[model samples]
Target: MTAASRGILRVVDSDAAEAERNADARSESQSAKDTAQLVELSKSGDREAFDRLVRVTHRDAYALALRLTGNAEDARDVVQDAYLRAYKGIDRFRGDAQFSTWLYRIVANCSNTHLSRRQRQRHDTLSIHTELIDTRPEHDPALQGDRAELRVRLDEAIRKLPERLRSVVVLRDVYDLPHEAIAAELGISVTAAKVRLHRARRRLREQVLPMPGEVPRP
Candidate 1:
């Protein structure tokens, strides 16, 4: 290829890339405008518009719930709960953000509540087991107490995590979701998801694990 031909080809490639980016930006802007219009209609008692918005955003919302809950059943329940809450609180959704962003945050918060309730149920079961151990002559009360305390600490650590980090940890460690799936569900790049998981695990270990040469609490 001649130098002049190569220079011309490079200019053409740059123009094409710039045009594609401009197109994407315009598309996103249009989508946001359409969503805002729907939000306005729904707030004014337009059920069909709201339903249309639901159809457009449901897949991403469900994906968010599934990653957090780690169960299809619970994900479905969370999504339902989220939509109901969104419907009732539609008036509270000021146009400060995109409708989808507001909606996804609702899903995340609902999933957090659901997970908390499930955790509490497990804690209650452990309490029952501890009570049973009190009556069993052969059971080691001290060992059981230690186990229960450790679990409580671990749960507290997980609960204390920021929502973004907590979601990654639950999806990656608890649910065994792949990095790509986690990324898709959380609307992040795979690298960002993996980084969040790393940070989350480190925070958890710092809270849950005993330091070297330090004795664990009894």
Candidate 2:
């Protein structure tokens, strides 16, 4: 290209980059402001403010509930009940943890309560088809098929795990809770939480790994 053309192109690219940077910065600033505003409003007992928080967190909570309950209807019920309990107990929130973490404790408890009730009624084994409906589909066909298969195996593996180990694994891996938060939520020491997580991971790995010569490594 000619010198003038090159100079114009450079200016255009610079302007585009600057615009993108400005947009990202503005988005970050707005997000921080919104978070702060919500926390302040929630502290003031604004139901709408708390509702906004729920809207943001509900997807994660629902996913965790689904993984634990292994049924869409039950997971939905758990999430709804958890939200209701959280709303009723919002005044007890001390802000020691992120609001999301506190909300997760409620979701976990709700899921546990639902599971215990189901166990008492002797209706705990979920079908693979039923479990599939509770999970989000993967975009790739091969990956989706693999995930579906894994889900079946994982469901069985999770069910077989000891309750304490299962709870830690679900909170840490499925719900993405940090070790400290998991311990705090479960009322266990952090070392105990880590040990449970370790045992759970080892057991899951052994359950999922293929037999010798059955699968190839990259």
Q: TM-score of predicted model 1?
A: 0.58
Query: Model 1, poorest ten-residue lDDT window?
Result: 125-134
Q: State residue 142's C-alpha deviation in candidate 2, in Å.
A: 15
**Lowest-scoring 10 consecutive residues by lDDT in candidate 2?**
133-142
Q: lDDT tens string, model 1, 2-120? A: 99999999999999999999999999999888888899999999999999899888998897687566568989999999999999999999987667767777776688778778877
Q: Rate the local accuracy (lDDT) of all candidates.
A: 0.74, 0.75
Please list the residue runs of candidate 2 whose C-alpha ends up more than 4 Å from where it truly belongs after superposition.
1-32, 126-164, 178-195, 211-218
Best by TM-score: 2
